[model samples]
Target: MKRSLRRALWAGAVVAVTVAAVPVTTAFGAGTVTTTFTKAQDWGTGHETRVTVTNGSSATVTTWRIEFDLPSGTTISSAWDADVTSSGNHYVAVKKSWAGGLAPGASFSWGYNGSGAYKAPLNCTINGAACGGGTTPPTTTPPTTTPPTTTPPTTPPPTTPPPTTPPPNTGGKKVVGYFAEWGVYARNYHVKNIQTSGSAAKLTHILYAFGNTTGGRCSIGDSYADYEKAYTAADSVDGVADTWDQPLRGSFNQLRKLKQLNPHLKVIWSFGGWTWSGGFTQAAQNPAAFAESCYNLVEDPRWSDVFDGIDVDWEYPNACGLSCDTSGPNAFKNVISALRSKFGSNALVTAAITADGSNGGKIDATDYAGAIGNLNWLMPMTYDYFGAFNAQGPTAPHSPLTSYTGIPQQGFNSDAAIQKLKSKGVPASKLLLGIGFYGRGWTGVTQAAPGGSATGAAPGTYEAGIEDYKVLKNTCPATGTIAGTAYAKCGSNWWSYDTPSTINGKMTYANNQGLGGAFFWELSGDTSNGELIGAIKGGLG
Candidate 1:
């Protein structure tokens, strides 16, 4: 029965979107620009405006463009950029390109000369959101003539302790940074930034891969392949170090070098994913052997030092994975217990569990709350509900951090998942919110804005009709927030994703929930300057 259920879930996730008239939006994995306009200011004379755009999305905004409809009676005259244009009242500001992209947390400013008194535009759009009304700067006052008469009192001096060594900066958050795995394949350039941003100093763990599984015989899937590519690529970098390096090539080896660069970073091997999870059933049949195999593989003398922990990513145990196993409700807990007994707490033991919270859905398949007490942290693979996969549908939400109107997949969103886990007995601090680094959508969509669907699945490298979060922030920003997540439409396509704006909100939610921290799917999927990670840090702050 479990095996059958797992197979059904896998079948559901693997199927392509049915053909439809509208274009389907991509999944929430890539195409999220972290940079957003936070606060905007206006100065007179073509009014110099100050806009605060922060990087919180998965990727950086290399060249940001701020466009808004200007008020009538005002025309852009002399401009600092000098290349901006005025379409009636509409004004568009483009980066010089030479300034390069703004790094995460980094801000950029430009001013324009225009006619008429400076007044905020009636309609304002910053990073695609309706910013409401413009703010007015406070007035400054001139000096007054009143004189002071009171004198200061004298006091005794105090002695200080003998000069002792000072402690390090030690930031408030322990796990401030985590590297997602997808970056190993496509955007391999960021491994260095992870090292440079002092992220290594603050980072405690790294989670690789978006969605994949323990294929036949405990073998991994495409995510492993991507990891191999990234591992090999790191070898090309002269003097680069990794924490999980063995003489043989792999992310483990590359991570070894990364650790050498920053000894604090911990690399853990995660198995099982949203796809290809059927193998867990087979492994569960011989949990002891499977656990032994994992121990040997992770602790192999060559790269043993690099691997500080092991994470079981079985989508769910006993219940089902991408495929199912009939080992009974206790199968998942047994497998995890076996792993824990074998590896012990000296090495980290963690897992990513199912977020579905329905009465008899995936949540009931296994004992999540019961299992979490023994593990260090529980990561919930949030996001990816309404995409091309459900083409020709009442568009459901994939990763709604919270609940909202028109959410087809009501209880399955992130918030419900976390709440359900907590209600089941999992401690809030033991939980980590999982944020998608990409967007999910279907092409051939017909609706111009938010709620719409595609006639069928659109083309994609791994999954049909889904795209990375980095790509969609610019292509299809959410018209408004749904639940805690956001959804938007571009042309006929419909998309669900988190932007720098929404990520900030998610971070706040995580802090409010007392979650251990947040984790994204893969690292390479984010922008070059490390925007998403920056948001994670700032949000924690």
Candidate 2:
């Protein structure tokens, strides 16, 4: 999923929409506390915001406060993770009552809704220190130790950490992962992490997501991010700096280098996500033309060697996603047929479709079976069946593998969708099960069991309702298992996600069902050591 689409996919319509923020650091006291303000969502007249506080100093901080002034015509409305008091356009926020002290290198974040378009907070101060880290007298002492010397590379580095374990076994199955283009932004996750985390050694294919479909043609999403930004010598994948006039740079160059390191990996360009699905209806109108345009874009001479083929992730054909699609049942099959015809049998032709298994749901609205002959593999997004999108929660696992007595919705689990597609004649060998590397959670919950009540979305470093599995593993470890998944209740926050054990169980089920393989939503969500993907490989073996 792309940035906006992932936000919307798990958080729902109103919660979708996010842009990267340039972090602002505060200087003055012993512990330098930095604050970053990000526009989580913007809707013309109003926007939601998140403020992150990072402690870079040696000492631990028991408490903190932030003060900022909004420009005229803008004001604060609602807030989370902090208590706010406003005087005209100026607002002061104190740490939330339930929050604990911040340790060195630790971070805390709070958010609010404000009027007018998203704007940077002016005259910002964190714990009485200038947010921009000006040369001010010591109000408090900060940073007892010298700052770390190495800065993370903007581009992938040439070095690869030795594998901590033996090479992963996929058992002739594919371990596909999606790498979001925008992850190089605020996420600070570059292709280098894939190598260092040992994921590159495990992955059989990497799907580069969201090459835009605009004007009914395949287009680049961000030119600078895709192939324009230059990489320094230290950040270059081959340890050679990007030239001023290189034909390719940015992520394209980095991926090309990554492919060199892992010859077994195939990269596929995936277009159309929740935010961009609206364009599919138009592309579906002329499947042959659409396929031709995509063919040209994928085989562009500049990066022709970087990709194997294409994967169309149109949200839905005759069904609904972020927006409803009225394209008849033939639209999807027609598009796939045209793509296979153009790309030929040598290239990989795949797709990602809805896992809705209800009778007459999205699965029943399209001609998925007809496209089988033309496609190499089809992925059923088995996750996101339920989330904090509905604020009041009956607290359920988001990616339940099987049905339970109190499942909120019938036929919403992973097994139901897989079985439904199999019944429709979609060969198990051509169907890959989808797993989300993140978790969906809610706050203000009173119970610990699956059935519980929640007031709203749980606070997250990036978005409200969702968080990466890497953070969730350490912050809120799972307490119990249910429906072949895991759930945890830490303090008042409740989260549901698949643990390594659960993923192992799921993978066993996948192998037993004679399925093709298992693919995750993306790679950035896994631990720095690639724990989850390791489980996937181990279980598949």
Candidate 3:
């Protein structure tokens, strides 16, 4: 009789185990990928927390499925990266594209919009154990601190809050440029060249791009390596190791070197690009929490010494970029609000926004003028007029400041964009005119001078029909100006841009219009001696 009962107990245990496995379906089916979640601290206002995911095991992770179960009382207000679906208290993010199927040892990340407290997951399972994590290690909670029984009166006298320093004078012109650290390899330029060439000295603010926001991770690419080398070169010039690197080193260290050389340059980290901007829509839900997380990462005493400001280079806030963000008009303002509250007035916050001037482009999707009210400046990328995208007969003007007859694309150029912004209530002093140092042209066109028919757009190294400004200056000289902007003609093709002569005209316009100043696409695209910056300085005079 005892033996019979033992068999029955064994059978019951088997049944219980089968029931537990019911909730676990094949973990990762064919072509499916998985992502796990890790929580981090929220620094302050205008910040959000970071979540990292690692792809384990051998198979390719074509697409990822991430499910975040928020703790009680905490919630998501916005999200960036993947499309999200929430039920009860659980938030799930899914990838739209396979993204080349992450290889073994590859990892991708995403961020969350959360509020209140943060905690680690109690029950977590990612694509089988081989793909990683089924059980979390037990964590020890620290004992609560006891307050002193009888506190003495605090020392009465102390220092007053320091006076706010006046923002550095931009000489009535906001100095701006895209500092491509990677140019060290392909274009061969250094940050010091920016300094000695008067590029750094005549400037007001600098944008150090692309730390990558798509994966919700802060990583340094090869370009970061080049930036490091540039800093080393700058230090050699000063003959002293930068005093700023004591706290943290890296790109920020290089920025410190630039500052030491000029004492006037302000560096702002620009997050996201055409490729990485999709995550921002997700991050917008919990705008406050997301801003707090960004604050911690940017000012994390670890690298705080290197940065004086933060800039959002989100391609579009409400509409679409390389990826679409349908989060609505308030998404951008909400995010910027969180940042301003957390960082206060001390840290500079700004943005680069859409320049599409058509009747129904990105500008129509959101209220940009309102969002930039608190910004130090607004940069409109006013180039990329015509490329191989339109392979038709009527070759249009690539960089015309204003619309003209025989132009290929309708209602696209700098003038329409500027007028739109001004009409929308954006103060002229807050707007910085964007100038491209390069030219866009078509190669197969047989016509001569400014207007002609083309077979296709000129081919480019990275994108179709684009060339650096420095190259264009020598290849094409100015033929005329439409409205304080320059255009030129090459044999069988037409190009538009601002030379030193035309840059002076742009600066004059900025001054007359009470506009902030002029900014260019990049620093390396200028002449070896930085003639563009010189023109800006000279023109502002």
Task: State each model's CA lDDT, in order.
Answer: 0.53, 0.74, 0.55
- Scored by lDDT, model 1 comes in at 0.53
Pick the TM-score winner. 2
Ranking by lDDT: 2, 3, 1
Model 3 TM-score relative to the real fold: 0.64
lDDT of 3 at 472: 76
Q: Write candidate 1's Cα lDDT for 243-297 as tens digits.
A: 3643444554566667777655667767665565676777778787888877876
Choose 1 or 2, whichever is better by TM-score.
2
Most lDDT-accurate candidate: 2
- Residues 303-340 of candidate 2 have per-residue lDDT tens digits of 99999889888887887787888989999988888887
TM-score ranking of the models: 2, 3, 1
* Alpha-carbon runs more than 4 Å astray in model 1: 1-193, 196-202, 209-246, 448-450, 458-463
lDDT of 2 at 493: 96
Give me the runs in candidate 2 sitting further than 4 Å from their true place. Answer: 1-170
The number of clashing residue pairs in model 1 is 93
User: Which of the two, 1 or 2, has more lDDT?
Assistant: 2
lDDT of 2 at 360: 77
